[model samples]
Target: MTAPALIRGYEVVIGLETHAQLSTASKIFSGASTRFGAEPNTQACPVDLALPGTLPVINRGAVERAIRFGLAVGAKVAPLSIFARKNYFYPDLPKGYQISQYEIPVVQGGMVHFFVGDQAKTVHLTRAHLEEDAGKSMHEGLETPGCSGIDLNRAGTPLLEIVTEPDMRSAAEAVAYAKTLHGLVVWLGICDGNMQEGSFRCDANVSVRKPGAPYGTRREIKNLNSFRFLQMAIEAEVHWQIEQLEDGGKIQQATVLFDPNANGGRGATRMMRTKEDAHDYRYFPDPDLPPLVISPAWVDSVRAAMPELPGAMAERFVTADGLPEYDATMVTQSLAFARYYEAARDASQAPKLVANWLMGEVSKRLNAEDRDIADAPVAPATLAALIGRVQDGTVSNNAAKQVFDALWTGEGRDVDAIIEAKGLKQMNDTGALEKIVDEVIAANAKSVEEYKSGKDKAFNALVGQVMKASKGKANPAQAGELLKARLA
Candidate 1:
C-alpha cells in the first residue's frame, strides 16, 4: 500500500459519498418525469408529493440500473434488498421521509482500483444503496421578499448512493477516486455523470490525525458538484482541522458547506449542521413497499448484456496491443477514448505509436481546450494517416506535431498537403545528408575532438549540428548515423 499522505505532521483521512442519479426517465417510486431543467414543481405527481390515498410503485428501470452498477464494480448484488423510511423533516422532501436502503443495500463489499499519479491504490466500498432524491430549495430568484422557493422537479428522482471506506489519505487520491468512479458510472450507462446538472454529486468526510493514532473527528463537506471543488474543499478543511488542534481546539463533527468564492477565492468551509448518526434518522423498513428480489437468472442476463468492462479492456490492450500497463490504463479511461485508440491503432498498424500520441499529444490538446475525446477535431482516421507518414519516414516527429497543429486549428486537413506546404519532408538522399554531416564535422572541430576523446555526449552534439545545418529536414537517425561514420 502507498504511504499515507501527510499534511505537516498529521495524516488526512477522507471518505466520499457519491450520489449518482440514475438515468431512468422517470422517478424511482413515481411515474413523474426525471428530466432536469424543468420548471419548478411541474414534473412532480401526487405520489411524489405524498398526497393522501397515493401509493408508490417501484420503477423496474431503476432496479435494473442498480444491478448493472453492482456487476460493473464486482460487488455482491443482494438477492433480496429492503427499502427503509429515513425520517427527516425538510422543505424539499414532500414525503417528510426519504425511501432509502439502510441496513441492507443492493451492492455491497466492492473495491475501486485506480492510480494516483502512477501509484496504484484501491478504495474499499462500504455499500451502494438505492434511494430517491429530494427536491431543490431555490434560495435565489424568488419573488417573495426574504423567502425561498421550493422546486419539486427533482423530487423522487432515482439515485444510487455509493459510500466508500476511509481509505483516501490525501486530497489528490480522493479526487482521483471520484474521477474514476464518475467515469465508470457513465461508462456503465447507469448514471449520466453530469455534475453540472446534478446528475452526480459528492460529499466528502474529511478528518486529520497524528501518525499511528486513532481516527479523528470528521466533517462532511456536502454537495460538491465539481472535482476541483472537492479537492479544494478537502484541503481547506484538513488545514483548518490541523490548525485547530495545534491551537488547542477540537474538531466538531458536523456537516459543512464549501464556498469556492470565499476567503478571497481560495475557498473555505463552514459548519452547516451537526452531523447526525444513523439512529437519529429513525430508519425503519417501509411497510408500503415490498422487499426487492432478484433471481440468479436475472443477474446472469444482465451480466451477459453488459459491455466489456474498462479493466478487462485495459488488460487486453496490454496483452494484444503491446502497450505498457500505464498506457493501457490511460487509453481506457473512457469508452470513446478507447474506441478512438483502437481505430487509430488498426488504421496505422502501430499500436505503441498510436498509444503515445493519444496519451501525449491528443490528451494535451483535449485538456488544454477542456474538451472530450468525442469532440476532438482530428478524426481517428486522420490521426492514423499522420502516424503512418511518421512511420514511413516521410515526416519527423517534430514535423508531424506541426502538421497536427495545423489540422487542429483547421489550417489544413490532409497531412501530406500540410507537410508539402510547410516544406517539412525529411531529407532522404544519402549524398545530401552526407554532405551536411561533413560540413558540420568540419566546422565543429572541437566537438569532433571531444567525441574522438570518448565523450558520448559530444557525439550527440555533432548530430545536433548536422541537423541544424540541414535546417531540421534531415532524418534524425540518419544524421546520427552519418555523424558516427565521419567521427570514426
Candidate 2:
C-alpha cells in the first residue's frame, strides 16, 4: 500500500465492517421467510421469536453462501468453526443474544484490491463470519408518543459480517474498498447489495494520530447505509477528533451514530455507547448447536461452481481486448456491464472504441437517469453499430455524439438511419471540400496571413471556418488535410 498523505498533520486511519445479508430463502437458523417488506412480525417463526422449547437449526443455503464468499476473497474456509452466543440487551434482540462466530470464524483472511483514484490500494480482510441479523426498532409513526415499535421481520436474516483491517489511510480509500467489496458479493450472487433496503451496510471505524505516534482512540460509526453517508460521517468524525486533540482533550472509545440532519443538516456523529471489547459480549459456545464442520470436498464443490471473478475478467479484457486497466475495471464492474461491453466490442471489432464509448457516453447517461446498464435505451448491438460508423469515418466524432443522443433519447433506433436523417454524414467529396477550403481562405484573409506568419491557432481558425461553411458535414481530419494542401 502507498503511504497515505498526512491530513492536517495527522494520519487518518479507517477500517470497515460490512454486513452483507445472504440471499437465502429462509432465515439462518429458522424456516421463516426471508423476503423483505412483509408485514411486521409476520415473517418471524418459532426459532426467530425465541419461543419456549425451540431449538435452532442451521440453514444449508446460508452456509453455502458463506463458503462462496470465502473462496471469492481467497480466504480460508475453516474446516471446523463454532457458533457462540453474543449476550446483549436490546429490544430487537428476542433471544437476548446474537448467534455469531467469535473465536473461530468461517473465513479467516483475505484482501480486497481497488483503486483510490489512479493509485492502486489493497485492504486486507481479517475475517468474515456468519451471523443472524437482529430485528429493527422503528421509532417513526408510533401510535403512542415517545414510543418505538419492534419489527422482527429481519430478526433471523442470514448475514456475513466481513471485517477489514485498519489498512485504509483516508476516506476515499475506505469508500473505494467498500464499493469494490459490494460489487464482488453482488457479482458472486451471494448478496443482493442493496444498501437502501438494508441488505448491505457498513460500520466505519475512524481515528487520527500524530505522525509516527501511537494509534489514538478510535470510534466506530454504526450503520452507514450509503456511500455518501459513510464519507460524510468519516470526515466529520475526523475533524471532531482533531479538534478535540488540539483542544487538549482526550479521545474516548465509543460507538457513535451518524445523523445526517444534525447541526442544521451539516451532519454530525453522536455517542451511542462506549465501545465494547470481546469479553463485554460474554461469548460462549451454544450448547443447543454442535460445532460446524466442513470437509475438503465441500470447499472443492463450491470452488468448482464459482464463476469467473472480476479480477480475472479484468485481466482478460486487458490481455485479449487490449483495454487499459482502468477501463477494463470499470466495464467489468458488474456482470451485466461486462456482457454489454463484450457484445459491443465483438460486434464492432474495435475494442478501444467500444470501451471508450461504453465508459464515457453510456455510463454518463445511465448515471444521469439513475438506471443500470440492463436498462439502457440503446442496446449493445445498436451501440456497436454506432461505433462502426465512427470507425469507418461515416460520421465525425461530434456527429457521432449527436447520433448517440438520438438513439439514447429514443429519437431513432438505427444508427445509420439517425445519421442519414440528421444529415450528419462526413463530406468526402474532394472537389466540394476543396471549394469550401478556397472559400474559407478568401473569407478569412486575416487568419491566412497570420498562418503564413507562423501562428498555429490561425491555421486552426481557417479549418474551423471551412467546417462551418460545410455545415458541420466535413470530416475534420480530411478537411484539415485539404486546407493544408491548398495553402502549400
Q: Which candidate's TM-score is highest?
A: 1
Look at candidate 2 and tell me the lDDT of residue 87.
99
Question: What's the C-alpha lDDT at position 252 in model 2?
Answer: 94
The whole-model lDDT of each prediction reads 0.92, 0.92
lDDT of 1 by residue, 338-430 (tens): 999999999999999999999899999998987889999999999999999998999999999999999999999999999999999999999
Which residue ranges in model 2 land beyond 4 Å of their true spot? 263-265, 442-462
Model 2 quality (TM-score): 0.94
Worst 10 residues of 2 by lDDT: 113-122
- TM-score, prediction 1: 0.97
